[model samples]
Target: MTTDPQVVALPMGDLTFPADGAIFPGQTVVVVAYAVRHAGGVFLFDTGFREAAPGDDPELREYFQKYALRTRSLPDVLAAAGVDLGEITAVANCHLHFDHSGQNALFPGVPIYVQPAELAAVREPDYTLPEVYDFEGARFEQVAGDHEVAPGIRIFATPGHSPGHQSLVVETPDGPVLLAGQAVYTRGEWAGIPGALVGSSDTRPGADQAGYARSVARLKALNPRRVLFGHDRQGWPD
Candidate 1:
């Protein structure tokens, strides 16, 4: 109900990050989403969380289930934040990973903006639970590159964390805000970790460390007055 060109952050759900050679091995990460009112409607940056039965091997489900420890409906968060489900005009994500896209069912037929590359990537084997991305009545708008999803809301390609990874840039009352998805996974990596963004460029093949570096650095250079992430509980410039 409040229109002030501001971005609001709220808790959507939670997930456990993979401990396999990762910074926060098997650590619990809070799933967060961003919402903003523009042009008489609300737009969601990401759907919080959802868990699904294993698609192929039953064991995969067992492991995946471990990652999705718990969840809360996005609608509840929206309601508490004073957002109307009917007012949501569109949905965009930093990427289509399970934790990020699981709740797409919340807004069936709503134009879900996604990167074409990400869509392609998921189709590959073992990316994630296909049911999460392929749901009934789910609508997707595949974008190839940087494009504005709404007035003052632009989604630009920042493929590093994922081949089709993207980030959101929105102009708010405070200033420009950047929702940097997994490009900057946590506050610790946000401190400085090139490999974390794109993998070890020199030793890793097709890691696209250069691409990830540029994308992460771009978000930093863009110098958003505030920044948010897919997994981090805290945002910068708080």
Candidate 2:
């Protein structure tokens, strides 16, 4: 506990769907909530699952067919991880995906950092559940670009999967750590798949494919010592 607590990955819930309707292993996603414990306080990155639940979006539920709509409580999950939710200083989301921002309502009046671009994107139909964010006393601190939210934590724009998608860069005692979010979908992508996204294209600026490439390249430029994800649940260190 002496060293700045390495970002803790909290398993919130699972998003599973028939991968191919064949005998192959079905695609199952474990949504993870990260807690970065700093000297100032515990800065939570992605607080959707307090207990466990499937996505609330109708289309997702109809297609996926399996997901817990809600979990216990954000505070309970934090407590189980030996983190007091009360000590939580602020919150941030990689994007406005339903699974990522489901439990944001837990922190009313608390400054929730999000990109203004994303805020605009979410207003469109079927983007995300509006109630999850537009709650009473909700305070959003719209950030435009890379910002140092804390002493050693910076949220950088990684837009690709979503226009406003962002990633966290935390300076741990070990080295720079990148919470890739969905910017880099899997470790395989980070490890360099031939068809994987690398950088943005000059032609299409915000296009999914090109934007994603640029975002990935931007993170790679940082040369983070450790990278985390929201869906990937594999062991980090072998």
Candidate 3:
């Protein structure tokens, strides 16, 4: 793996949700966006949530408002980081949650990487908050298994949190850094402790609690040097 790639974490917003049942009171969970500078230009990991104005999707609007989440416009955030939205060559989402894909529209021409199963779920009528399925006008590359999106940056399917959920592993100078996304929400959760996740349903295979545990074990087996969660906290140390 080449050693020059740069990974930058952009703070999109915060959430006050719990990891499992434990009270993570005042947890400043940043929407946790990432950018990778590669020969192809820039690659975005996940698009953080964009706030909805009045009369938008009722369920979505209500969730954001109730949580008091402050979202940064995708274009503005990229500009502030010295990244031009149009220059971004590709985009990849960890999952198709509203909080993760809200800003996908910012890069209309970039191909967004997502799993085939996830795409189907996003289109299902049973899925609530249909806006989460919104792709924001970007092209998509539906991957079925583990593959490299760029040199030194690989994506692995880690289904359970969502059917098509995935995580990224970037070969960094320090070592391999796993962008675990929702696979694990915190260091403790990733450690196999119970009740470490939220917003999961029981219907899907491995969507419930045990699935998280299995995912945690799978990640641990990789022994990554560092693990960054979807929501902000400290990146886990291996």
lDDT of 3: 0.74
lDDT per residue for candidate 2 within 40-94, as digits (tens), equals 8888888764332364456645533544343436677778888887888899988
TM-scores for all predictions: 0.85, 0.81, 0.82
Q: Write the per-residue lDDT of candidate 1 for residues 1-238, one digit (tens) a residue.
A: 6554567786877777567724356667788888877875787888876655445457646756667558877788888989988889998877777778878887889999888888888887656666766688988999888898777888978987677888889887777888887777765566654434322232322236777888888888887888888777777755
Q: By TM-score, is 1 or 2 better? A: 1
lDDT of 2: 0.74
Q: What's the candidate order when arranged by decreasing lDDT?
A: 1, 3, 2
Q: What is the C-alpha lDDT of each candidate?
A: 0.75, 0.74, 0.74
Q: What is the lDDT of residue 4 in candidate 3?
A: 68
